[model samples]
Target: MTPLRPPRSPLGRRFGHLVGAYGLVALTVLLFLAFSLALPDTFPTLDNVSAVLSNHSVPAVLALGVTLPIATGKFDLSIGYGLGLAHVVTMQLIVAEGWLWPVTCLVVLLGGAVAGTVNGLVVAYARIDSFIATLGTGSVMYAFTGWITDGARIVPGPHGLPAAFTDLYDSRFLGLPVPALYVLALTAVLWVLLERLPLGRYLYVIGSNPRAAELVGIPTRRYVVRAFTGSGLVVGIAGVLLAAQQQIGNPSVGMDYLLPAFVGALLGSTAIRPGRANAPGTLVAVTVLAVGLAGIGQLGAQFWVTPLFNGSTLLIAVGLAGYAARRQLQRRRAQPSRPVPEPPGTAS
Candidate 1:
């Protein structure tokens, strides 16, 4: 007979869980420290800190947006395209049409919602695979982007974009970049929505098992639609921020963020709440990428290094995420089954 192992103490189990949850966070800190030590002058400076935050905030936001649909076991490949169109439109409205900054932002956000709704409708009602559907939608959005820009960049006039618009991306808040603050606020909101709300639970359930969720009377399709819509809205916000920061809208800028956003979101699944996508985890993942890239750049890495790193990280993250998910499922299977309650008036 196999020897039985001693049961773990509750304290020990809790400690283990804590480490598992925050291990990536710890890794991020370690990477920062190591780089700071290695490149004392540049890596540890406040200027470098601000630059990294300012440069990466948009990608971080996009990563967070992608996390929602991922939490529902879906992907939003069209986010980059949505982002491209949203920002271009923002520029077209504000720079070309002389629309007020506030009005332009609102319209762009609404357009994002509409785009997300179309993606949701196509995926849920049409019963198409999210990967293929989003890709198709994304291509269409890219086409629209091209049409809007006429394959050219949108440069503002001599007066420049409104200060209010540029401030959205350029201003600092309490010594931190405003865009970074936006990322933090968005992360907190998504954390609450995904981890503390019934909506989150419903989405998680659907993600884990659609049939099981349906059997439990959860509206999986509607929730899936909601997930995609939320993603689109967040993408819209990021696009506006991108436009504000770039000041000159490039039709192809959206795709630049795509890889890093996905890399962050996927790698994040293997940390924090392992086997699951969470907002906090996504933030942590983006930090890791940002730090690594900043450090590499400071080390005089080549231009191609960034994409290579992102692509490699993406593949590894996917593998680890899949392995972690399987492990979680196995753990569930290993647990003792609960006894079913006897029906009322049917048993003693």
Candidate 2:
């Protein structure tokens, strides 16, 4: 019997696969060039670069926090409320109770971790759907935030915030804002974890197929819980940075970051390693967003346009991610199967 072979994919199919994989990156570069051309005086300058870096760093960090849960095929909606709670707690400790800044920062970070563990327990052990569980937990966190602030901002006392604390977010290093360095450091850490570590492999396996991961003896529930816990820790750090930047605790500030963070994470799934959420892709997505927003703002767009842009871009990102995932799946399906060997010495 003759060995059967799958037909070669058409040139158009191969080209479409390549485009699906790299289209977002190309789009980002093109957008930057277009903006530079349109606003040559402002968009292409170092000062604008610095401003975008400083302004978007917090959202970028927050987006990374969400990306972890996303990688595990879970959603964490409580990050926004958790961020507000952590920062507000930091302010209350430092300004109201006169606690040391370092101690306050530590306590706030631990609190965020605890909140994350609770979310994990609810989602993993209690068997609640992640979206609903996180939404409920986030609402509770919001209530706690309101209670802490009494619906008011926590302004610093007579001494004001320590210069060292404020400098964490406001200072520059090597001609670039320190926050940008923080983003780079975090991205490196996450990339190593997700791409190079055993723990990361397990998480990816779980995300890709929970049932198969469990059958393979991977601790699906435990790893999912851990993912949420890790996300919480990152959220805590972001909250501390947020406090340092604002120098005040506003209970309502955290929700503003949620949409942008989700936008970056989801948008990122379409680029770099398509069909998966990865650190490099998230960073790229954030850069695209930051540049677009900065260019539009410099163009004197109305206030409502920013939110509208973000919302619309999010929808487009989701659509693109689905398209990319589908393309990848189709490409895999179209690949030829291995050739079967002939019987005994009758091979071709």
Candidate 3:
């Protein structure tokens, strides 16, 4: 008689599945290596890494903000303009009004939350399509931003901004830029909220099927509003940090971040937790973008190269996300349904 052998465990099978699922992360690694090889001296250094982290942190935050709304099947185009407006408001309150920095920060953040609430009400209560609603609000925000600045920058008085205020973005914690820490902390908070909380589940359910969520008594409208509000609040936080980082309200800086932010959020859905927007996945996506951009810059790429890269990546991300979703659906369909068990004495 042949000796009995144990069957393979699910762990081995899951390892293969996880590798396939995390292909984007693998691609990121490959891109990093390619850059390091291409620019051996400059690309693999700590200074380059620091620059990438410091520069991308704001986009990372904005990406996280948009991720929340996207999770609920909504989009907030206003985040870019809202970021500019919030920072402009912060500066106006500080330089023109001479308000305390801390107090000004609070007011700016509150304004952001209020902006979010308005967006929520428009999309949820008014029953407008989120894309159109946010686009309208975003345009209005840009108008307000331009009106506030009159097409000029908001510079601080000769005394300069408070050390504490500037420190929020410029200071280092554990040998890394403080804004990077903010990114990590926010990612952690969002991960917990989305992956480990009831609210997260509700949002995903609504995104997956609003009608089914309504049938299951999930208060879809209220939750969608909350999602947009949360996004607004996060965008406000990003604006504040942007103010700290720039130390001047440029009015035009916010729009530059919009494409990259959405790209990160959308591309992220194809990895880690495929077919869903998740925090860890977004972080990974942002890292890939940062690495690729930094490497390209070091290679003496032209200024226009940056936007070209971003736009192309956005298109690719969308295509990959759709492909991954279809693949997931096809795999599910391929699995055999449970066969009806034979009645007693009916088996062959």
Candidate 2, residues 93-164, lDDT tens digits: the string is: 989999989898888888888888899899999999999999999999999999989999999988899998
Instruction: Estimate candidate 3's RMSD in Å.
Output: 7.9
Over 26-127, each residue of candidate 1 has an lDDT whose tens digit, in order, gives: 999999999999999999999999999999999999999999899889999999999999999999999899999999999899899889989999999999
Q: Estimate each model's TM-score.
A: 0.93, 0.90, 0.90
- Clashing pairs in model 1, backbone N/Cα/C closer than 3 A: none
| Residue 113's lDDT in candidate 1 | 85
Decide which is better by lDDT, 1 or 3.
1
Candidate with more favorable, higher TM-score: 1 or 2: 1
After superposing candidate 2 on the true structure, give the runs of residues whose Cα lies further than 4 Å from its correct spot. Answer: 1-18, 330-348
- Deviation in Å, model 3, residue 61 alpha carbon: 0.4
Number of the top-ranking candidate, with lDDT as the measure: 1
Mind giving the per-residue lDDT tens digits that candidate 3 earns over 1-348? Answer: 998877558897688568756877998899989999999998888888888999999999999989999898888999999998988988888888999999998888888888988898999999999999999999999999999999999999888899999999989988999999999999999999999987888888788778967776678888888898888899889988998999997988889889999999998888888888888889989999998899889899999999999999999989977776677666657787433222223335
CA-lDDT, candidates in order: 0.91, 0.87, 0.88
Top candidate (TM-score): 1
